[model samples]
Target: MAEVNFCLGPHVGLRPAVPGIKRAPDPPESYSALELQVAEPPVQQLEVISGVESVQLPCRTTAELHDVVKVEWTDSGDRKVHVHSCVPEEPEDQNQVYRDRTEMREDPLRTGDLSLTLRFPTVRDNRTYTCSVYSRAGRPRVETRVELQVRAQQVEVDSGAESVQLPFETTADLPEDTLVVWWCDEPEPAKKVHEHGTESDQHEVYRGRTRMREDPLNTGIFTLTLNRPTVRDAGTYACRVYGAGLIFLREKTFQLTVKGVSVLLLCAPTAAAVSLNVSPNLQQFFSDDSVSLSCVVGAQAGGQAVKRTAGGQTDLCGSGFGTFDGSSCTVSGLSPSDSGVYWCEAACEQMSQQVNISVCPRNDFARCPFILEIPALPVTAGSEVTLRCRNKDGSTHAVYFFRNGVHIRDTTMQRVKVEEFSVSEVQQSDEGLYWCSTDLLGPSHRSWLSVRAPPAPPPPPSVSLVRLICLLVVVCLFCICTVLMVLMCCSRKTGNKSPVAMEMTQCFGEYDDIAAGISTEHDF
Candidate 1:
């Protein structure tokens, strides 16, 4: 053991001056008797804006400390935020508010980056958080505290009445002496509409019209009531709550919109008759093409139609569609979202007419526009021909067929199918223009057909002279052979040998010889 002696002066009982006290030099001990304690690192403060997509809570360790096997995060209210362990491989237990919103590094033990990511951060997440690490032997090692400050959220409110009350509340428990101020539009320079403790310079417009209910400590309600709110009072209003020593606790902003009689007066109408019609009246469209719709406005029916006319709305066309003139709209490279009821309205009598436009994908032919199919032109007059009307999507409605722009007939099928009109033994009258229409939004295109009569074939060919002569020779030979046979039989019965019979028999014998030779040649 080693003993030390202090060289203190007589003034040691009082506060010692510099160089008044000294210690002995040599000590034979291997180590000092007093142990020095190492203090933990200071807490980190992180500020975040409300409604952020994500936030990262940092907690890092060094490379030499490889035994960091577990990380735990807990809120200031004693609620578990997240827990990651390498022990039993069981599921972690997290708070309901932070269940699906928290994530850490995939290989945290190796990387030493045990950072928590909170997604879709809200205002209620502002508080103190603790992150503690443990070794594989279940020994607590390092810890860190984080202070999270989230900025206030902004809200929008629209009112149609003359008077309105804007309500505000906070989750933080503030003290009784906290200062609360209501500011309009800009709260940085403090556009003080109303304040709790002190009198401030307020704008002349809101000096006597705005009031606040200062029950922040008891009921937590700091509602603002504005009397006779006009269009000029429509803007952002912020409620700033301050703690002791003028420290800002939290802020809440409200966007107000006041709609009164003055707004209605700007939208008043005039007295006149108006009518509208759409050109190139496309009942439906496809996504691959562009659409151009022109609204033709007239003072009366079929009287002096004009384009570029403004209607009740400031812009005549709606969203996803643009206007060159006030009355014409063009939608380029249309999409399925462009399908809706499009209307043109005039200021007089609120006159408006709607045209439904349906946009479909290029691959979806069933929802495409109507089409008309016609047979080949110049068809035979006695042939059966058919005309068909087809829509991309099948319909069960009655299909009407027209000829020369006049209704001819309608066909209704059991199951809604493509419409067809067939003409049996078609006449020349059926040669006119033809088209078919179903329940589609518009008429189908027309096609022309021409009917023609079939021509008569040529008469049969006349016989040649050589063939006529051959037929006569065959008849004479047959007669001669029959007579010879009769005469030979009669000569045998009556023993009568006539000259004419003998001559005919000689001729028949000669003819028989010629016939035999001819038959032999034909056989070869």
Candidate 2:
């Protein structure tokens, strides 16, 4: 138990003094109870142009304390101020308006920082605010005046027309007398379309199409609708508030165009008849001897038809075939010129279809005549001769040469060599009626040869001498007959005398010419 002390210092009544136990010494001032002091009051910054949702305040203090601290706030303004703290729990004592928004914590004391946040802040709610801090040793308080400002909502639209619709999310608290205006660069005169109040502000073009929530003043919603949108109905539109000196603006645009379909052509084998079909006009077929072409068409009412060059579309008749209709097309009469891929196009309602066609030619070398010719004949034996073998059809594919009904060789001879068969020299052995023939393509031709031996040499002169001697003997005999005739004539006269007489006459004449020096060897 500690001692008790009673003492009365001179003032009102009689005094009594009883001090038996010594009192504890008073603590030094440094360790005594303390009270915090702020150098300046907290102040919320203000701006003429401001946002509707938030406000900032600048505040500072001069208090120096080393202990846990607690902060308290009170909204002194007439309007509601929703207070919020970055800390975890709500403060001990707070205004009813901040009952749901207030927060507090111990972390701020450790960091030596303090701040308060107000939610759903507004211009009308701006006012003075007071903050008090309770420390282990003392209590400190700060007061600040905050000015609030409201910034106008901004809207923008992109369009060529004079006016457009205005759209908004929350329209609550919006005044009924709010003004909305439409703006754009006027070609002739620069002016703006101004309307007052949400009710009377009707744009002629957007009149029936405009609408708002039942309680526009409370919901703060303004919506404009367009029933039949047109290109001329597009431009920038905005809402303005005259009292608050604020302007809220929004912008829009529209575009217009026409629609349409297509036409196509089709063709096939270039040398043959081509087929085509169309809804609008009949297809045309054209050809030279080398190529045949077919045109396909579609109705002009729905679309346009055009000719597409080669390689423009896929061929319906395989890779080389060409198509012309929206479905298919073809071209025929295939020549060298027509031997390419073709395309046909059908355009309708801004859409088109393409088709491809291909063409090819038939081979004509298979039908030439097979007849061959053998130019000249009557070749001499053993003399070199050439046989010309030619096809009447002029086809060299089947030209073959034959000798004596047997194929000897092919006729690949040069100019004159093709004319005849040659033999080095004329001999009796080569005396046959020789000929050459060729099965060029169709028929064959044959030629003949005529060979004869030369005449024999003249006979010897000895045989002629022999024949002359014989002729001499016959002359002698004839002479003897003549002598006999004469002798007989004489003998007829002298025969009567005797035959010896005639002989003696002949012998005597011969001996007499001989004795006379006439060479008798010539007569004898």
The most accurate candidate by TM-score is: 1
lDDT per residue (tens digit) for residues 160-197 in model 1? 23357777766545688888888875422235677765
| Candidate 1, superposed: residue stretches over 4 Å from native | 1-38, 154-524
lDDT winner: 1
Error of 2 at 453 (Å): 99
lDDT of 2 by residue, 291-401 (tens): 223333333221223333332122333244433343343444434233222222222211122112212122322332321222122234445544333333333332444
Taken over the whole model, the C-alpha lDDT of each candidate is 0.58, 0.37
